[model samples]
Structure formats: structure tokens, C-alpha cells
Target: MTLPTTAAAPPSAPPRTFSAVLVANRGEIACRVIRTLKEMGIRSVAVYSDADKDAKHVALADTAVAIGGTAPAESYLKIDAIIDACRRSGAEAVHPGYGFLSENVEFAKALDAAGITFIGPGIGAIEVMGDKIRSKNHVMAYDVPCVPGIAKPGLTDQDLIEAASDVGFPLLIKPSAGGGGKGMHVVEQAEDLASTLLTARRVAASAFGDDTLFLERLIRAPRHIEVQVLADNHGNVIHLGERECSLQRRHQKVIEEAPSALFESLADGAAHRERIGEAACNAARSVNYSGAGTVEFLVSDEHPDEFFFMEMNTRLQVEHPVTELVTGIDLVEWQVRIAAGEVLTVAQSDVVLQGHAVEARVYAEVPERNFMPSMGRIVALAEHGAADATVSGQQPDHANVRIDSAMRDTLQITGDYDPMLAKVIAWGEGRTAALDTLDAALGRYTLLGVDTNVEYLRLLINDSDVRAGHLDTGLIERKLPSMEFRHAGPRELIAAALTLWLERPGSAFAGDAWKVPDAWRVGARGAWTATFGLPGAGTATVSVTEKDGSVTAAVDGGGPVNVRVADRSGTGLVLEFDGGLVTYAVGSAPGAVREISVGNDGWSCRLEVLDRAERLRRMLSGIQREEGAADPEVRSPMPGTVVSVSVSDGDSVEEGQVLLAVEAMKMEHQLVASVAGTVHLTSKPGDLVKADQILATIHVHVATEETANTGQNTDKEVHP
Candidate 1:
């Protein structure tokens, strides 16, 4: 999907440029724009919330301004605050990087009214293409192929129901002004349509500040393809090929690739690419669009040749890096020039898709726990780059790998906005090679504090269906159930405990304990016992002894194994155990915070080390409590606002029944009943609960007279 090259005359004037530009966003995107601004010799201004006071983006900018609170509505979404910041910073232009106010029409108009340039499409284009309903209607007039649905002007609820009836069952309801899968629902049956519509509207209003929705026929198993369009005020527009964004989870894109694999399957691949490119250009021309934008399409899986108009994003997309990699074009630079009234420099024929490129979003979320978002300090960060690249902040020049991140060691990831921490892009001569590089990059990248989906992305890229390019929007959801969490094994545990033994301030021996490494102990030795707890994996007693010039170790009832300590460095130990050499990098905090990583395999765990006697006492006390079990209380898994309470006090519910829903990081999670019993609700709707706070108590029923009288059983609560 290369652009055609043609002979052209030189421009009569120099390209327009700005003095300073303010980035009205946060996180990786803000860092990305700032890098480009620095390359262009323009001053970069950054705005941050309370949570991002010490963020990487803030440090990268030439000047920083604190807007408001941690939440988006109080900060990034406040147009007045952003405008004032721009004025205070003396920035002549503003770049809304992808999210926040990037596609807000009012924001654009306000910037224009204040005599500051907006480095994106014009307000008219944002107003028309930003709304899905209007965008479809506007495109249809130009004879663009669009999905059949209802978008009548001034349509009422009855009109929507009538349209829904005509569209048949399995219709999709989406926010007219939404992107990123927020407030989108597929109603499989008529009975649930009304309820789903209500939820969709509420979510849309909350996320996008718009409750306007449109109904469309649900295209089952569809492939999502979007073409990047760059237009100039001089009426010149061109497309930078397409991005395949079919791999998704919960309707949001997780992995993306450029020069879509689907194009290679077409008989006339070049012609097919040209057709889509022209349509995308036309979409921009229809709205007199200027600067950077994206036109999205839904291609039917059964009919790859057929594509329908979905909507247009009037701002740079989150997946822009993929497009930039293949084209070797600086889209942000072009955006700034376009807004400065510069004419298009790259012609449609000059665009070329060099090599295959792929991008996988690294999010601070745990895939095993229903992809729940995580927040905490990033205790350790490692990005393996080329031999010549620096491990610190220096950008990697490896042709195969590129990390677009806003993360640094000791940085905190707060639950204020999107959970994505970074985007890892890999390029190669072909698709397979690119995917291989991506897989390797994910393996070498190490992130400690917060949970990430690096392993899940690795599994997905290697999946047979994914490798064969059999992609669809439902792939992640279909594959999620089969993905297993890799737990730390016994060998890893031993290394962890051994690391604690060596690194915990003083010698392995405590007060009154025999100093084993004494002058008399050179030839004689005895077993030393230490207790280690692997959080959810229970506790174990590790026995170590040096016998006959060889160290022997045992855990629980396991057989003794010969162990050799080769060397010791700062927080790193080289051990020869189980007939193999292993390296463990350990991070120790006072008390029981011992984090250990097993070699370069990216397998790590946080284990607690305690004295054997204390562990024994706790273990015995736990057994005593189980013998006299009580009703289990259900607790909140994380700090969040309770969005819905579905059950009432004294209500009898079955196992897996929904008790309430909690909203954290814009994602809603339902708390379910652990066992079939009478539920005593403790928290009500709209309550802000902390992690592990009691939400409800379930009293199980038993047949035994003693148990019935005590009203208790040995049922343990399952934490998700």
C-alpha cells in the first residue's frame, strides 16, 4: 500500500511553523508529541493533574502547569483551565494528543476564538465527523458505502424502536460521539434492547459527555480497518494506507498492524488499497477537513472485499505509531505544518509502506483477573534495547524495536485515566518477522510494581490463528478463557527465600541463634529453617544445610537437593540448583517485601519471609479458626465507587449471582455471590469503598446441629 510518486514543482514559500506548542494531554501520548516538538525546535508545554505531578511527561516538557484534580473532568476536560495554561505558558498553539479534548469541537472553537492555533482538524470537521450519526449521514450523501441502519434527523424513541425492528435482531447501539468502545452494546434479543440502551446512554454521557446514540446492524465477526488521512487547508488530502485493528478485548483494540494483512489476500491488492485510500480522502474532502484525522470502516469477515463507513476520528489515533513506522513520515510534524497554513508536501503517489510494523499496548492491568486495571508505584523498569542504546531515557535506535512510553523507575501509576502505560512497536521486512520481534521485545521488557499484559500479548502474537492472520474483533474475548496465569514454582520460591537470607541487613543468624559461618562451623554444619509466604500460594518452610561440602535444601515434604551458591552481587544471586544455573534479581524492602525475578525469563514474584516460629504459630491459629468457621464476608477487590447494588439485605441468592458493581478506571466489575446463602449487604450504591472493605456477608446453611446453631461453615471467599 505505497503512495504513487509523481513529478511536481517546488513550493513558492517556506513551510509554516510555530514558536511554542502546549500538549493538552497526559501519559505516553503527551510524551510522543513533546518529542516531535523538540525535534522541530519548538518549545513544549505540558499540563498535568494532581496524580501526574511527577510524571515523566511533566519532566520532559520545557514548562509544566497544574490544571486541577486527578479525575479527567476536573482537569484535562476543563477547556478554560487548558486555555489559561496556554496563555500563561505563552504558547501560540495547542496539540490535543489523541484523547481528552482532542476531538472536542468546543475546545477547538475556543482555541480559535482566543487566537491560538489548534493542531488538528477544523471545528466544522470535528462537529460533523466527531458524531457517528452525523458522519455516516454526511458520508452517505457522497455515495460512500455505509452500514445500513437508522440515523434520521430529529428521530424519536419510537422511531428508533421502529428502526431497530427493521434492522432485525442482533443490532448494535453505540454513542454517536464515542470512540474506544465506550458506551457500545450489542443487543442479541429484543427483551434486553431497552435495558442495554439505558446503560449505553448512561455510559456515553459519563465518558463523552454525550448521551446521543445511534442504532446500526451488528456486523458479527467483523474486521476493523481504518485509513489515516492527512489534509491541508489548500484542499489537498491523502491517505497513509490502513491499520488492522481487529484484535480487541471488550470492544477496545489491544494489538494493531499497518499495511493490513487483508490487503495481501485481495487479487488486485494495489487497486483495492487505492479504492479505500480514495474513499478516505473523499471523506476528508466532504467535510473540508484539514490536518490529521482517521476514517474507520467495518469490513465483513465473510466478504473481505466489502467495507462500510463507520465513523471518522477528527484527531490523531492511539495507533498512529504503526502508520508512522511503515510510511516513515512524521504525522505530528505534518499536523503542525498543516495547521500553520502550509501546503501538503507529500503527495498521494509519494506515500510508501516500507516494512511490516506491529504495535501492542502495554497496559497496567492484569489479564488473569478479568483484565482489571492496576495502580501502584513502578518499583522497577527495564527495556532491553540494542547494544548501542542506553538503558535509561535514551531512545533505542534498534530498527526492529521502539518503545513509546511515559514510564520511569519509581514512577506511580494512578487510577485517574486510561490504564495503558506504553506502546511497544516492532518492525521487520515482513509480517512474520515483525511479529517475532514484537514477541521477543515483550519477553525482554520487565515491569515490576503494577501488573501488565505483556505475557498475554506474547501468547496472542504466537497464537496459531493470529499468526495466520485470521483476525476479527472478537478474537481476544474468545481466547481470554484459555489463557492461564503462570505462577512461581518451588525452585523460584527457594531462590526468593535464599535471597532474603543473604540480603536482609545482618547475617542469616539472629539474636541467640548460632553464627553458622563461625570459625568452628567451617567443617561442621546444621540445618537452618526459614519460612516464606507466596501471598495467595500459601506458606512453606525451607530447610537449608551444608553437608559434605555441598549445600542441601528441602521444602515441606520434598526431597533434599544439592545446591551451590556460585556468586552474590547487589540484589542478584547466581545459584546452581536442580542441575541448572539460575540468576535471581531481588529487591528487598524492610520487613517482608521481597521481590525476586528469575533470570531474563520475566518470571517474578513478591514473597514474604518470616521467622519459622512465627509462621508456625500463625498456621496453628489458622487451623483453629477453620475448625470453628464463621460466615465469610465478601470484600471489595480494589478501591472504587460502587456503581450499582443489585441485591438487598436478607436476600437469598445463589452462587455467582451479581451482588453489586464497582467502577474503577472507567471499567465496571460485578461482585458476585460466593455461595448459596442469605446475603447481608454492608455497602450501598454510590459508596466509595477501599480495597478489602466488607461489601457483604454471606451466611451459609448447614445440616449439623452445632453448625446450624453457630451459623458458620468452612467456606473461603474467592478473591478476583
Candidate 2:
């Protein structure tokens, strides 16, 4: 089949300030670049993978080019394809947006050789700073306070243990060429050193194509701070203050803010700022850095005066918006100007940091379920911003909120890329105001269909420790597991139940119906189950019961809920039966699912029929009743690739033993044995398994008939 195109011959006009720019990225960042281009009156060109044909960024660009396959390696990282895209789109420059080929020096060199301007630091700077070991050596040469560690690579397990001992207990074993905490492990004692090193090396090899690792003395309760720097080709550099990124989980930053409170405690704030700023400048100068970059430091809270250079990101960071908000400087514009042979517009002394800014990344992940990446369609996204805020009249400039997002009401959150859906930022004159604004915005922002960490973010912003600015890299790890998954209030639960009930099949309110029989049953009220199409992009089942003339419903899927409905009489239904009042509006038809539009919170629920709902329930009931069965079967929880199988047929295993390991979405999970019995494994390593697939079975030995019956009853209770 011939592909459709609106191709035209190249323009005959001479180049007018970068006629076009090729965005060598995807998703929000690509969209961000295109927005900047449009502001500068430059045409924007977008490149897409096979999977991103319908992505938001592609539709937003002036022109789009399809590169290759869905995966990063096959498309975004393919230098030749990117260069070809630039040529096809008549783009005079290429912008590598923070990932894929952003830090790849070879790609920069290739762009230079192809005579296309790369809108970032030059190839030399990228080469120097891309290698962590080399960058460490370069920074240390300038008397920067470097982390206490060695830069050598390829150390044996014994050497690693000895290095850890010298660095002291609780040191970090990190890959020599790593960032984003990949291939890094924390060793609490000498005994854990060897295993941690091996794991780190393996992970590093797979991720960065380097198995070399290094040791660093982990600073106890260290807060992560990074200074944003912009430099021109004409030997001028300025620091844009610091961002405090202490709230992180598994070495990934979830929240970031500007002008840390810890900075205020230092005796000589100006002097300390100058010193750190100078160090960051020197580090940038070491690589002859130009354009926008961030120099990260791990500052010790115990010894507030002391700080060590962590690493330098050669590209714009994911959390650069907070800096932009407080400084009122567009880093992207500067990057474009610098690449076009422009001199520095602002001097170091001219730069002034003002106000407080906080940014929270809203990711498609379940905070209650190990922060696992979630993927699906964003049925509804309600983003709270200054444009939608109420005027409080307290501060003249207190609009306070900003949302940077690429998702719309019907966007799909695919599993093929990063799970971050949006970045929400709040700016205020003081820290308290910023924190309060951020918390309130989070509370008002509503998302449906996929799981997100919105509630978790709210918890963090409200926590006494976070509010008081007592933050560190380990804060989330120390507090998150206990904080997440706590029950939502009864009101929220009732709202979810009502949402489910309204979306059930045969419910008089199935469509956009305004009225239903006063006491009409929605479905088969006896253990009835019907799927509900949620606003976000998935279907969930609602089990309804109608015993003793009372209606009861339970939602059988994850994520939050917001339901609103009204009756034909124009009276809003105050669904207060489930401990909360779910305000709803009546619709014209039963097919018109309940939709809730509160401020920026937009969500809807559609009723659907589930063919297997009844069958599954019957199967579960039958399994529960067969309590004295001789053999018990085990099933898979989710679809995944089996990474390992530890047991074979006839292998005796204790309860809670790991029977197999399955990998899904780059993370590993173990399937544990639920009973102490002889294992009969049905699947082996490297097999792809589906949810509820019988992976294994176990047989329990019983001494007597009575004891067997008792054990069977116990098994049924435990499994159920």
C-alpha cells in the first residue's frame, strides 16, 4: 500500500533564523520543544516510532516523520534514521530531548558531521561529561568537593568488599557509567557488598553496555540538590540557583523544589551559594560546557556546610520547570540561541532567584502496589492550574499552579514508554504557600482508568517532615510503604461503589437515562456481576446484591472514583448509603454513563456486559466448596515472561517459598508457594504465562481421614 503524504519541494528562500528544527524525541518533551519552536516562529519537525503514530506530539508538530519500530533502540536512538528525518523534513537543526540519544556523544558528532546544528552542548562537552568516571576525574581536578570514592573500573568482588570497608559501612556500589539510579545498590554492611556488586554489575551491563562499577561512601540522610547552569560559547556562564530533589523512591526523584530550606541555615548563605555555584561552573567549564545543564550535589544535613559533587546532566532535566518558574527564564530558548552563535544575554550577577516553586511528577503507577508502572488509556485527566484557580485576594500574584502535560481526555497511556503523564508545579512567595497550593491542587486534580500516585504525592506534601523541609534521598523509601494503601475514607469508598453500580449492565441508568424505576434492580441481584467502562480506559466489574430490599455494590478493580448523577425530577441523588454522598446527575438514556466534571476533574463511567463474570464467579465458588480435594492448583496472577522456575514435579516445598520468578515491564516478581506440599510444576523457565494460567500444583500429605479433612478446609480458607 502506498503511504499518504503532503510532501512539497524544499523552500527556495534563504535560511531565516533556523527555518526548521527536528525534534529527536517523543511524548511530552517533543511536544514541549514544538511549543518553543512555535513561540520562536520556527517550524517544528517531529519524529515518531511505529507505536507513536497517534501520539499527541506527532499531531501537534508542523511536520512528522516516521522513523522505525516502537522500541527506543529501533527508532529514537537510531542516528541514521534521525538524520534522515532531519533531511526529509528540511530541518536545519536537531533537538535531543533529555533521553534516547540526548547524552550520546557519537550522535552529537554525527549531527555535526551532517552539518545540522544540535541544540545542546557541543560534542566535546558531551564526550567529557557522558562518562561518569572521566567526569568525576575532571571535576575533582578543579578542587570540587567530589564524593569520597575511587574512579577506577572493573574491580573484582573481593576488591569491591575491600573498597566498601575503606569507604565505611553503608556505602554505594554504582556503575561507572550510570544515572537515574540504574545499576546502583546500597550496601549496609560488608556482608552485603559482594552480592550487591554482582547485581549492580549485571544490571549495569544490561542497561549501559558497561559492567564496570565503582564505590562511594554513602552520606547518611543526604539531600539531593542540583544547580541549573546556562553558558554561551563566548566564555560566559551563570547559575540559576538550586533545586532540592530529596523526595525520591528507589533513587528516582518524584518531587523537586527550588531554594531549599537547608540553604537558609548555613551561616554564610551567599558565600556558600557562591562556592557551590562556582564549583558547578568549574565543573561545566571543565568540559567546556555550553547551553543548559545541571550539576547535581548530595548535601549532608548533619554537616550542612559540606556538599559533594554527584554528577552533571549534559541535557535539560525532567524537573527543569521549577527553575523556569522561579527564575522566569526559558532554558529551551536559551539553548536554541546559544546553539545559533548567540552570546550570553544575562550575566551571573544579573541572575536573581525569587519565590518558591515545587514540582510533582504524576506518573501512571500504583503507589500501593510497589510503584509498578501502569499503562492504559487516560479516560479522564483533570489538571489544576493557575488558569483554573480561585482568586483568594491574599497575594496579587497568587495564581500558584501550573500543569505541563501532553495527555487529553482520550489519550492512551501506553506501556512502551515512561509512565509520567504530567508534571504539576506550584509557585508562591513562601514555602508554606507553595506547599499548601501544591497539596490543594493535587486534591483537586482527578484521574481515572489508570493508577497514579496523586494521593501519595498529597501525603508527602502534607507530611510534617516534608512540610518542615526535613528531606533526604531516603525519605520516600523510609515512609512510602507504610503510608500508601491505607483505606480511603468511607466517602471515597462509597463514591467508588456508586460509580460501579451506575455502570452495571441492565441498570436502569445504563445509558444517559434521566430516570429509573424507584426500586428497579440493575442486574441479576443474586451475586450479579457486570463490567463498567471507566473514564480512564479500562473496564471493571461491579458485584451487586439485593438482599433485604437494600442495594449493595462493590467495585472489582483498582484506582480512584468520582461519580455524579441526578434524577428525572432534577433532584441530585445524594448516594449516602456507602458512607459518603455521591452527587449524581440524571442522563437522557441508560447508555449515558455517569460523568463527573468538578473543576478540572473530568471523569465518566459507562456500563458494559461481562460474558465471563458469571462463569468466573461460579468457578470460584466450586473451588471453594471442594475443600477436601487431593490436589490443589496454583495460578498466575498476571501475564508475564517466566524468568526462572525453582521447582520441578514432585519437589517438596514449604509454604511461602518462591516457586518461580516472572518479569513484567522490566521489573521482576516472584510467585510464592501457598502451601507446604509436593510441587508439580506445569511451566518452565522462559515460558510466557497469562493471568490465571495453572502454573503449578501441590499435593499435601495427610496422616488420617479426619486430619486430611481439616487440612483441606484450611487450604480452602487460605486460597480463597
Candidate 3:
């Protein structure tokens, strides 16, 4: 394929400044790009799916276009829809924000063919780096040190086994066409090679539509490091130091830090940075790359001198903000300028590392449930004030803590997009200061209704291993079993109990009674018992008994405790009892009350009664029944397409046997028989199944007495 040469400026043609650019992506990245365009005096166009019609990014954009259905493939990934949106909206350029089509070679080519400048690397660069095998070979050609691996095509099962043996145990099987850790597996022993290969192939085939796999030697206790590179059409390229993305879950980065602690630990830190930077520059120059790109490497923990190339992301990365914080450069602006036939203004010598910066990706996910994406309405968002604050011995004003978000209280978080809600970044003169500021900022941050990984991120920064920078891709999994949520102390608990009790249905101050001083109990004590729902946290029911002079409360199934209520002149009621203290400042209002509670541990909280019926409905709905009575028929656990049905009607199968396989989210889940029985297949291969669909029936074989009893129980259960 012949690459398009950089066009020279025509004497008669004027430099065209785009009036508006259509963001062909969703979520934070879309918002990030729009912010840059707005700053540059350019109008921004947003495209959204049915699920994101009212999203924050859509509202923030100058104009919005409804693309199509909710799924990415139908909306954001639809090239024609995006192009039409640009044409209809008078958008001059199309910015495919990372993910959907950001690095897609065909997408870039289509944009070029349509005479729309794609705000990213050229199609040639994207094509060269989009394929893992091709990118690996290209990087190696530049003498860029890479992980010893095979990128050759067409490897049979036996060939892969032999290659795995040659690479030795503890190797990685990765798809040559995949990235983001998808279609990747780690084999710890020779016996696990075959299974790992099958799994990797299956996932790769499903995700990238390519089943070819490659092998690489696994680096033990490796830290993920990547150097940011920017290139111009004028053959100018430079490196922007490195960011440490060691904190990960299932190979997905959760937190990233610039000027890694691992780098500082080296005896020759300055020399090592220069070496890595040069290699990264060479890799970019080899591809004649343009715009913002990231060259990732896996650095050895024991030997910091050794590093290997992982892959090259041909666009701005999710954690690019960390680099921006330290370098003080707007990568998006540079990408636009460079694409406009501009020269690189900043040289390698001009690039300076200012301070330590850390960024935590706040994802809408349940950490307790293996980080599954959580979808729901965002009820509230609270963030701490960014001011001069000393944390972890570093002053934020001096270190600089920044919060970049594209979320508002009214937006709905749906599963159709990436689960990330925001990126919280903190900078400090040193590692301790940076981490400390981030931790403090995280503690003050709050999101309600939908579960977030904020609490988990807080725990991770405070963890002993993370604090010491002993991190790897497997850190989350290894430490998850021992991880626990930070709990509200006794003082906070007591205050919460008192607040809920005071706001109970039968309380003395019922519906505007607080506004009438005459309604106050001259010397009467009021008491009530109520349940307080904690959402993700389990509920706690408490009984509050008030006397003429004092109030006493007892938590459900617990001992009684005295409560001290202090009246703050105009603030509200401050309840102090047990080890917790909370302040309820509802004023003299007679309607719903909003209460604030502060634990002695520094985790402050607020509770508000929005609607009684709605709250009750939600609280009751949160409780899920166990297994729905366990029907004898095997059902699909999630929405997916059946790949193959292994059994037919009346075929005898053993317990724990695979009945069929369903693929969802690029992972294959096997629907297996719980008991040995004759299978009655109802769904065939390639059939689309919804969650809880009865794929097959299992008729158990038993003795005469057992059969009679089983039949009776089955009839009752099925009928009930």
C-alpha cells in the first residue's frame, strides 16, 4: 500500500481553520477533545447513542447529533453515520476519540477519502501499528528493545506447544491482532499451555475476528511503563518522558503516574530516562508517525535497566493527563497543529519533568464483584475544593492536584460504553506528596446511586505495597482477597442512627412541625425505630428513644447507647455519641431533611430523604433472590450467541459437563449441566439467547423410588 505523502501548502490556498469538529466517540475522551476545540475558538459537535442522548458530553458540546442505536457498533462505530453527521452539521473535521475507531486504519482512510481531515495519526501509521505482529516487527526494525517473542503467522496447536516450550514456562500467549490485554493469557506451566492457547484463540477470534496467537517470555514482577511521543508532518519527533501504569486489574490500567517511582529508584535515573526516551523516539521516526502516540514497555522490577516493547497506541492515551500535568503541554492542541503542516516547536532538550503526577481512573464498576461494570443513574457528585492543602507532606498548591471529569449528577451510566466516569489527578514535588494529595482528594470525593471504584482507588494508594511502589498487573487480583472497604466509625454510625430516627414516620416533628416552635415537645421525649439504607453498604436498623432531657438509641440487635445532641446557634443539630459525630442542619424546615455526618476518621457523609416510597422501593429492590429456585433446565447466564451445542435431546451427559458455550463481551462462558442427566437441547449453534433462557432440559436418571419423589418435587417446583 502506497502511503499518502504530506501535502505542501499551495500559494493560492489559505490555511483552513476548522469551525467545528464532530467527535466520533463517547465518554470522557469525547469530552476531553471538545474542551480543546472550545478553547481554540472552534465549535464542537457531539454524536451520541440512544443511551447517551442526555449525557454530559452531549450537553457540553455546541451541538449534538443522534447517530443510531445504543450499542457502539450501531452508533459510534458506524462510519457512514458519523460522516453524515459531520456533513449535516457543517463539521470540517472528524475526531475519532480513542477506542471505537480512533486507531482503525480503515476509518482513517475513509476520512481521508471523504476529504475530512482525521484528527489523529495518518492511515499508514495506524495500519502499521494496528496489527500487533506488524507493530512488533516495525519497532524491532528500529532496534527498539522488545520482549523476546514470535510474531510469525500460522502456528498449529503442536507448533504453539513447541514454541511455548522453547520460550519456557511462565510465558504469555497474546493475539497478534489484539490490544488492551484482550485475547491474552499467561501460562505458568507446560501443562497449562494447551488450555491457555485454546482460551486465547477463542477470545481473539471473538474480539478481533482473528484467532492467530503469539508467544512471549513473561517478565516476572514487571512494571508497565510507556513513553509519550509526538511527531509532525515535517519529520520532527520528540519524547515526553514516561508514565507508570503499574496499577492494574486483569491487565487493564486503573491508575497511572508520570515519572514513575521505579524510575527514581534507579541508581542512574537520568541516564535510564534518556535511553528509554531515545528508543521511543527511534520507534516513532521509523514509522514516520505523527500526532500524539504512546510506546508501551514492560520494565523488570529487579533490573530496571531492562525493558521490552509491549505495543504502540497510535493516539492520545486515557492517562495522557498525567503527562500533561507534568509537561504543561496540551497534546490535543499539538495533534491539531501538527496535522496542519506545522513543525514541532518543543525539542527533546526543551521537555522538562516538573513534578510527580498521579491519575486514578474512577470507573463505574463494582470492585467487590470482579470490577464488573455498574450501570445506573448518577444521583450526586461531590468533590473537594482544590486549594493550597498539605497532604502526605506535599502541598497540593505546590504539587498541583487536578480533577478531569465529564460527568454530572443527571447523567445515566449505561453498559453500552466504557465504565469510566472521571480521571482524578494529583501532583506533588515527590512521590509521597503526590500519593498523599491524591488520597486526600479521593476521600473528599463522593458519588451516589451508582457504585464507583473510588473507595477501592483510595485503598490502593494507601496500601503498603502501592505506597512502596511494588506494583504489577496482578496487584489488584493478589490483594483483592485481603481488601476491605473503609468503614464509618462509631461516631458516624451513632449520628446516622439519630438522624434517621429523628426523621422517622412517627417522629414528633412530622411534616413541617419543625417550622412551628409550638410543635416542639416542651419537655416530652420522642422515640422511633427506623431502617437506614446504605446502598452498597448493608442496611442498619436502629431505635432512637428520646427523653425530655436526653436521647438514647440502640442499633438493631445491639446494646443501647446514650446520644448527645448539641444545638449549633444557626447551623443545626450536632449529634455526638459513641465514637461517631454527625451534624444535621435541616434548618427549621418542616419538609424532607438533609443531614450531614462526619466520622472521627475524617470520612464525612450526608444523607437526604428524597422520597419515602421511592427510597423504600429501591431498598427492597436491591435484595436479589438466590438462583430463582434452581430449575432443572440449563439456562444462559448472560445475553450472548450460542457458539456450539455439545449435546442433543435425550443424550446422556455427566455432571459438570459443558452443554453449550455462549460468548459475551469477548469472553466465552460455558453453560454446563449441574447434574448428570439426559440432555434435551432446545437451542442450536449460532442461536442468540437472552439471560435465563432455558437452553436445554436435563431429565435425571434414578431408581423407581427416587424417580417418583423427584417427579413430585419437580412438578411442585415448576408449577410454583
User: Which candidate has the top score in lDDT?
Assistant: 1
Stretches of candidate 3 off by over 4 Å are: 1-16, 154-159, 385-399, 487-540, 546-551, 562-575, 583-720
Clashing pairs in 3: 490-580, 491-579, 491-580, 491-581, 492-580, 512-590
**What does candidate 2's lDDT look like per residue over 1-720, in tens digits?**
111121222334432378899999987778777877888889999999998888888898999999999867899889999999999889999989877788888899999999999999988888778877778888898878888886674577777776676778778878877776666788888877776676677667756777878888888899898999998776777788888999998788899998876785567776767777788888888888899999999988887668999889999898888888778888888888878777776767566777888989988776766776665455445565632222121223436677766776556666556677778888888888888888887876766545577878888888889988899999888887678443433333344445445555545567643353323445634544455333322355555555555665566643323333333222123554435545432221222233322112222222233346544664575566556543366776545667678777788798888888765554556778776877788899778887458898877644555658676543321332
lDDT of 3 by residue, 1-720 (tens): 111233343424444578888898887778778888887888999999898888878988999999999877899888899889988899878877778888888788888888888888877788888877788888887879888867777887788898776787789888887876666788899998887787688778867768988889888778899999988877777888999998887677899998988888777888888888888888888888989999999988888888898889998898998888788888888887777657666877778888888999888766765665554555445645332122221333433666667777646665456667887788888888889988887876766545578878888899999999888878888999899765544445556555545554454433555553332365664455545544333456666776665777776657778877654333244766664665543211122433333322223333333346745765564543234333457877656678867787778788888888876544466778887767888999878877558899877665456558666533211211
Rank by lDDT, highest first. Answer: 1, 3, 2
Model 2 worst lDDT run, 10 consecutive residues: 1-10
Model 3 TM: 0.79
How many residue pairs clash per model? 4, 22, 6
| lDDT digits (tens) for residues 1-720 of candidate 1 | 444332244456776678899999998889888888887899999999998899989999999999999889999999999999999999999999987899899999999999999999888899898888888989988767999888754555556776788887799988887888877888999888877777777778777877888889988889999999998887678899999999988888999999888886677777877878778888888999999898999987677778998999889999888888788887888898888888887888788898788999998887877888776666567766432212121244555687888888778776668889888888878999899988888887777666678888888999999999999998888988997767666677677656655543334322332533422344565566666765343677777765566777788858887777787765456889867897765554442444343333554555556655657776885775565454267788777888888888988789888899888877887888867777888899889887668999887754566556777774443321
Residue 348 error, candidate 1, Å: 0.7
lDDT of each: 0.79, 0.71, 0.73
Cα lDDT for residue 278, candidate 3: 80
Assess the local accuracy of residue 413 in candidate 2 as a C-alpha lDDT between 0 and 100: 65
